[model samples]
Target: MNTPSPARWRPNRYQIVTISLALAIALAFSVFAFQDFRQGQLAFRVFNDEIEVLTTLANIQRHQALMFAQTLAWLDDPAAGKTEIEKQRTFLASQLRVLRPLVANEPEIEQRINNLQAALQEYDRLVESLGESPSPQARATARPQLIELLRRVDEALVKRAYDAQERSFVLDFGNLLRNQERARALLFGVSIAFILLVLFASGLYLRSERNTFNLRQRQIQELQAAVNDRTRALELAAGVSQRIAAIREQSQIVVEVVEQLKQTFNYYHAHIYLFDENRENLLMVGGTGEVGKTLLERGHKIPRGRGLVGRAAETSQPVLVPDTVADPAWLPNPLLPETRAEVAVPIVVGNRVLGVLDVQNNQVGSLSELDVLLISTVADQVGIALENIRSNQVVERLLQEYQQLIETSPAAIGILDAQTGVFVQANPQMLEMFELTPADVGQVGPIMLSPERQPDGRLSQEAAIEHITLALQQGKNTFEWVHHTRSGREFRAEIHLTPAPNREGRPMLNAIITDITARYEAEQQARRRAERETALNRLTQAIQGALSVEEALQITARELGQVLGRKPVLAALQSTLLSYDKEDQ
Candidate 1:
């Protein structure tokens, strides 16, 4: 494979000079073409101005000659009115003066003006000659001769002047228009050529740009391929290292593995967590680097089907979160702050999952295949360790419960030697009632009780011991006694003693003492109340069966009031059923 050249290559000095020369030539050609076009347009404008002036002069000259002809014709008629002659003269003079100034610069127009003035003078002379003839015959003969002379000169001068002006306009103004049209055509052709040249240059520039773009694209593709290969190699190497190191049992050690791997490959933040019993959540257990404590303190958790972590757990696969915002599976983790990329690997052991391991960064697409493989390998080890810890905890809990159940029993049970009354074991309550702690309760010495209980109408220590010995010897199972505690509180208890025979047939007493203090007090109170209830029942029966109200009152007062030492007031009941009595009576 051919390696790409470094990015430092720039246009060489010769190339720069060549490009500059090309631009300068193009600019010079454009400037020259523009100047040519502007000069041609200026020439056409000058020609057009001259043509307008010439056309206007021609119209003026024509109008003047027509007016002069009318004036001479009117003067020739002997019977022509003075009013009509004077009107023709005034109109002719106005046209001559107007035409004269308009074409004053042209020699042909100047000549035309002088001829018009000469014709006007000839007409005036003819008019004055006709007026001088006194006889009508003389006037008639003189008028025809003068009229013919003036008309010939006026017609010759006006027609010749008009002919000269028309020729001058056709020769000068028409030639100017033809030259202007030819100049515009040549300018238009030059402009078209310049536009074609610009288009050609632009096509060349675009082709060069396309070629450059294609070349750059190919270079970029090659560079990317090489980079990907190198990245894969680095990833594999780092993965091997991580796999070896991350197999530690400790969660902190696994995190250290992530840190070392990150250092080897240069990554951002790294974290790992294992699931609790329920795989519905991810608890952050360990992390590496600067934000490790922050993540740990935040206690970030991912619920099942909640975020990227949850998705990975649910699928039991690895997940790569490319964008934190766009991915619906991604939830904001303040600990991973501004993190745009993340990877989560399931820590699976056997068929069960321990937790998830995560690597995160503020850059998108940070994790690779190597990260996935390495973290998964470490996860197996973590899962085993977690399982072991949980199993041990379960066993310990069971043992505690068993011990607690033995202590919490209400029966005061003790173990004793068959031949001797030596105490071997006692429950906590049993010891407490005897005013002794566990330390002082069980001993190999003789069994003892309060000396005062014998005289106080409670069971004597000697008698209780005899009873226990007889129960062991005869296999009697149970007996009852009124015993006094060390605190002077009396208790009625039933002692159930059994002979726990050993292999030699020598038996130890297993005595179970159940405190019946509350039951005994309740029995005594019941006996006293029963006697009062019986007396009240008899009195109520007497009152209910009494036929008269006075008899009922007397019986109630004598039986109830005398016994209770309280006055009884009798009120007549509305009915026998309404009276307070035993049963329905």
Candidate 2:
């Protein structure tokens, strides 16, 4: 035999497809990951730019406020106004010197700043003119002109500020679009390259058909293991991603609906304040966490317009308090323990502030501008949800009160499904009268009160249920029955049953059982004794009237005394008188 021609085998369809597809997919993923990394970098840059813009805005607002305050102070100075006004001029020039360089390359911005400077000069002239007047009356004459100049300066400042704001918006929008486009292009290019690589791999797998049987077997096993591993990894990743997405969605919804946003501030406590449903008072809704629960139990209240949160609600403006510890506008919270930073945004719908959303941080500068923006987005969802939750609670509370009233009423009240012979409800009194506890009320059937059948030939438990069902269907009122307890005590009950309406508008039966066994027995005993007494009295009277006094007395004494256990006239009468006398005394 010519050394048996080495087994020549072609690649199986599954092996070729799986290997080629896996290789292509891996390559595609690598490319996609690179693109993703680049996109992440671009997003990070955009975020940084946003932060820078916010910082600039903060600085501008601070500087402008300070400048306005100084200008007002200078207008009040007689000497400074009459003379060179050296300090004021120097300050203005210094501010401009710094501002000028910032916009030097941007002609439009520079020109705008220069215009504001010219307006400020006009404002100074008007202030100086008022200062030169000799008397209050003369100064009053220039007051209108001074007011006009100040107004002009304000208008110019506001215009430039708004312009800068507009420019920032435009730049942000443009950069965002550019970043997205670039990421998309890179992703597309990589995807195409990955597809071509897969095609090449497939061709190679087909051409290299000769199989070393053992090696092929080993490769197949390895491939199967890799596929299993990849599948498991993908499943885990998908599960994690879904969970994260759900959390985000729920958080967003909660933030929108809740008023006076209840949030956990720390491990130990949470703070809840009232938010206006219609710009009224802050309302406390729900809170958890250890510290949060304590704060709510302590009855923390945020009066409208009292604190940062209240102010936001009252003014219908978002308030970001940088340092809660230092800001007087932040009402002190005993539970807060010097909260370092806080932001409150009004949750408004169509100009009506529904509630205030507040977020707190323990460390200074812990909350960034992005946090405030994100919180605001969440607040929009929270506002409606909060309102719905509150309304639901109110309705639920009212229903509970109604139920309580029914449960405690003197009437033995109970609800049952007549058809099923199931107890839907039972009052305390009803349960007690039946020797039942709350735990037993819902579980036991109506016929459970009857004796159960024992294995030792006692009454069958099933028989008692049949009796109860028959009685219920008959709608019998005032049916006398005796219940033999597990302790063998027989309790006679007079039960009354009536048709009860079910919650679903179905007919049900309510049976009221009254224990009348004692009463019935007592009444029977009294009637029997009364009949015996009547017979004896008649016999005694007949004997006294028909016979002589001596004989009649003797006979009456003997027969009546035997029955009554007493003498009629002397001894008994004396005893009765003495007893009455003693009782009277």
Top candidate (lDDT): 1
Cα lDDT of model 2 by residue, 1-585, tens digit: 577888988888976876777677767767777776787687667556544443343334333433443433333444445333444455556656665654565576567667767866766665555555345433423333343343444445634654574466557655655664565566455545544544565666433422332354466456556545544543443343233324323333432233222321131222334454553567644343455556556655577887887888888787886677778787766666756888888776434576676777777776666555555545543543444344344434534653675577775666666655656778877776666778875576455565554334546455434445664575334455565543456677666555443356554555566677789899989997997788688766778576564465556556666666664544764565568678879
Candidate 2, residue 538: the lDDT equals: 76
Output the TM-score of candidate 1.
0.27
* TM values, all candidates: 0.27, 0.31
Best of the candidates, TM-score: 2
Worst 10 residues of 1 by lDDT: 568-577
Backbone clash total for model 2 is 21
> lDDT per model, in order?
0.59, 0.55
lDDT score of model 2? 0.55
Instruction: Give stretches of model 2 more than 4 Å off.
Output: 1-95, 128-138, 202-369, 372-585
Evaluate model 1: give its lDDT.
0.59
Off by over 4 Å in 1: 1-248, 278-280, 368-585
